[model samples]
Target: MRAAAAALAAAVALTLAACGSDGPAAPAGGSGGGVTGDVTVFAAASLTESFNRLGEEFEAANPGTTVTFNFAGSSALATQITQGAPADVFAAASPATMQTVVDAGDADGAPTVFVKNQLVIAVPRGNPRGIAALGDLSKADLKVALCAEQVPCGAAASKALAAAGVKLTPVTLEQDVKAALQKVRLGEVDAALVYRTDARAAAAEVEGVEFPESAQAVNDYPIVVLKNAPNKAAAQAFLAFVQSARGRAVLGEAGFQVP
Candidate 1:
């Protein structure tokens, strides 16, 4: 009886050990369905309004998660990311700017095109200058504001101008699209070349004029997760949210052409 009882106890110990070992394994790099923590996004100035809205929605959906944004010119943002700015995601206004990050291997994978934008003439609320087309911007009397050559909006403006055969000397070159549009809103300049979405966002202060030449300069917006993203899981989740159906609707309402 003592021997049998001892054997039973030993078997029970072994069974208990086996059951303990059956528990779930530890997660790798904190990845999985339960996405938490802060997600930092570096995006273009043109995406300011739409991204802000999306960020709010994402935070609401993912409790305990916060979405932070650094909105600036795509070129400037790219430079910042390459220089080691701590960002989980980067959304550029053009592919050329996104290439800078990819070239530096700062991106985790190939960037995906999220949307497209086109240039437009943002004029004051009342057509005070009677500016109708790209050609009108060439008039010496009209003080026009344009983005710097290095910025995506500026590059698109250059392409549209070239296509329209219009040589324009802008009164000022801004670092981003919003700054250019601000010149029009503040009555500091007669008009400015900015993204259609930006112009629409500021519709109460300015009006957007679409030109046929804009078709030649449509900009493809691209987004990517950084290689050293602190919260990779959350970053990926936010990226998917931006590419999701709900994200498309928000972008569409903001005048962006979602893909």
Candidate 2:
């Protein structure tokens, strides 16, 4: 009887050990589903408004999870990410910028295109300068602000201008779309070439002018999870959330073309 009892106890111990070993594995392919933690996103300045809204929705959907963002020019953000910025995800205004991160071996996988944006002339609410088309921005009398050639918006502006055969000399070369738009909003410049979404975001202060040439320079926005993310699971979750139908709706409302 004693020997039988000892064997039964040993069996019970083995069963307990096996049960203890059955904890869930790390999220499959780091694609988060049951994750709970802080998720940090490094995104382009152009994504500020829409991303902020999405962050709120993401947090609401995942109790005990928080979403944080570092919004700046895509180039600047890319540089930071490559230099080891502690970001779980990176969303860029252009593929070129996203390539920087992928080239640095920091991105977990190929970036996915989430949306597209087109350039628009941001003029004061009343079109005070009588700007009507891309060529109008070239007028010597019109004070126009443009993004620096290094930024995505600036690059798109250059493409659109070339497509329209318009040679423009900007009064100011801002580093980001928001800065260029600010020049128009503050009356520092009569107009600026900015993203349609940005112009819409600042509709109270500026009006968007859609020029046909802008179609030639539509910018594709891409997003990816970082390979060295501290919260890989949460990062995956956030990325998936952004690609969901709800995410597309938010982007659509912000004047972005869902991909």
Candidate 3:
């Protein structure tokens, strides 16, 4: 009886050991239902401040994931992406610019409008010029800066100016909104037409003037994942985070209108 009991006990131990070994294998590094590695994003210059904050928040939420950014004029970024620049995502200040990527078949899916921005006349902190409206920019004595027509801010500025029936020339045509705003900040120009959110971001250096014509020139901001993304899983996750409630809150704080 003792011998039989010992054999049965040994068999039970072997069965238990086999069950433990067969239970699922440990998750592999970087591929176990979790995002990992780097996600590269190409975004418009206007999104610099808000997107920077969003990038930090995304990295914190996903351990071992890195967020890299390339911020520039939406038109420029679109050219780069179409020319084969490796990027995981693209966020543009205007649907027209986003369409460039879509037309080139570089976007993985249809881009979504995430926010809206309007043109605002940015001036020195003290409003020394007394520039109250779009017509004010037409004063011959006033020097102004504007973004290049290829840029979203510049296009919006054109629309606002046309809407207001103002035919003013700028002292300089910058490549991006920040450059135009910089001209105002440095006092090189009396004023610049920039996005309301940008003026708010640089509140310490400039003040935004609201004009009725700006209502006619609001630009829609769109974002999409690249078709050839190296880290597609992480890219999709980052896109989701940008459209999430937390993302809307951060953008709202930055003065972007949720779409």
Candidate 4:
């Protein structure tokens, strides 16, 4: 009889042990869940500095996680993501570009506007050409670098110029805002129309000239998760982190107006 009792007790113990093991595992990083592994983000060129800072902070918060970024023109990034680029998240400089992902069904949900930026004329330090307004870009003697029409910065510049009733003949058309800004920094062009954030980030190298027409073409920045993200959990976590208070502080420091 004692043997029978001992056997039954052993069975009960084993059952209890199994039940305990079935409980959910604790998340790696507090109650935020297990946000380990890699998260690849495709973002607009203007977001380079701010996003890099955010990525480092995220990795530090989640020790086992890593954040990688691909910064370029928002339109190009949208095309790549739709074409099956392995991006976990996307941050666009304009709503139009973000809509491309939504239309292609690559976005997980409706994108949220994270920030807003306005156009500014980026010139070499000290404003050598003495550019003061959108109309100044029209002067044939003043070499100007403008972003490609397909790019967000270029589109904004176009609208700003149109609003100011000025037509500009760019000396060089760049594929991205950073490239356009680079031309000014390198003295290849007298000035370039880029985002206020970009000019502010490169304040030491370039000076941002605020024009009245810039208010007409403010760009809204949006962010979303890719539907086929390789690491959905990390993607979601990263998105949340970006919209968090700390994230806003980083972007604000870069001259991006929080939306």
lDDT of each: 0.88, 0.87, 0.88, 0.87
lDDT of 3 at 82: 98
**Candidate 3: where is the Cα deviation over 4 Å?**
1-33
The RMSD of every model to the true structure, in order and in angstroms, is 12.3, 10.9, 12.2, 10.7
Error of 3 at 169 (Å): 0.7
Clashes of 2: 0
**Distance from true position, residue 217, model 2, in Å?**
0.4
Displacement of residue 70 (Cα, Å) in model 4 is: 0.5
| Candidate 2 wrongly placed segments (more than 4 Å) | 1-32
For each candidate, give its TM-score against the true structure: 0.87, 0.87, 0.87, 0.87
Q: Candidate 3, residues 223-256: lDDT per residue as tens digits?
A: 9999999999999988988888888888989999
Give the distance in Å from residue 256's predicted Cα in candidate 3 to where it truly belongs: 0.6
**Candidate 2 on 148-245: residue-level lDDT in tens?**
98899999999999999999788889889999999988899999999999999999989999999999999999999999999998898899888888
Residue lDDT tens for model 4, 29-85 = 222444667789999999999998888777656545767899999999999998989
**Runs in model 4 with CA error above 4 Å?**
1-32
Model 3 earns a TM-score of: 0.87
Clashing pairs in 3: none
